[model samples]
Target: MNRWFAATTAAALTGLSVIASPAAAAQNCGGPDEPAAIRFAFAQLPFEPLTGAKWDPTPVASNYDPCATLSTILVTVEGATGSSPVQALMFHHGEFVGTGTAKAHGFTSLDADASSDDTVVLTYKTPDESTVRYRWHDDRVVMLDPAPSAE
Candidate 1:
């Protein structure tokens, strides 16, 4: 078989489901059968694809948006400082798009919804069984409501 973006064509794009735990931050990609795990290593984020013969990320949740022009991958990573459990990451066309983060407990899952104006609406789920709504732009994630109001 042949593919240009074969490497990027990995897993599903379902929302995340996080449970708060004292255990170290980790990303469960590829299964025990496979042996490749991508660690943040440092606080600095990665913008490229991690392809290793040793491991294949049988990711728990993923969301690939065709509407999103940039070919991006969404993953959760822990901070290098070890302060936060996990943070949502977006890599587009092998370039770092942006990231979304929450409290120390960390975010478990995420889903993106594109708006008519181009802004993306991301719904983040926390371990506490709470939801955070945000308006995502090209470079930042702003906490805002998507509902229309005023009479």
Candidate 2:
């Protein structure tokens, strides 16, 4: 009886941890459903018929706090080849808003992070790096600082 009770207790504790892990992780970032956010970003891509395009496994930036009034996430949609232009997608409150104005071309890398609860800073590397800032206003994401044209 003692052996059975100990095993049951251990099993219960393990189950509780498994259940708590996801909640703990969600609180840190990406809200309760990260996959949902990824799917939303993919569907809102400007280029249709995605073809060989795929979303990068990890988000370039995300500040998805459930308790915050606003949250943002940046994801990259990569093309089949390194030289292909990559799209930087933006999401607000888990809803697909739009893509960053900064253009990433020819294997250029892009990264972004939330500087504040309502502001996001994007860094684009086209051999020379440039930064752009966007803010969440009203119900839209607005570019605060425009990036230089890749002319």
Among these predictions, the greatest TM-score belongs to: 2
The lDDT of model 1 is: 0.33
Q: Name the regions of candidate 2 deviating beyond 4 angstroms.
A: 1-32, 46-52, 64-72, 77-84, 102-114
Candidate with the greatest lDDT versus the true structure? 2
The digit string of per-residue lDDT tens for model 2 on 1-151 reads 9999999999999988866785665655545466666676666654423344566646555665443434555544553444455555555654556766644443334332346666666665654566667778898888787663572
TM-score of each: 0.34, 0.58
Q: Tens digit of lDDT per residue, candidate 1, span 1-151? A: 4464553343211122232221211223211111121232113543222221121123324443323333223343322222223334443322334554422223344444443222333443432344445444566556456322211
- Model 1 steric clash total: 11
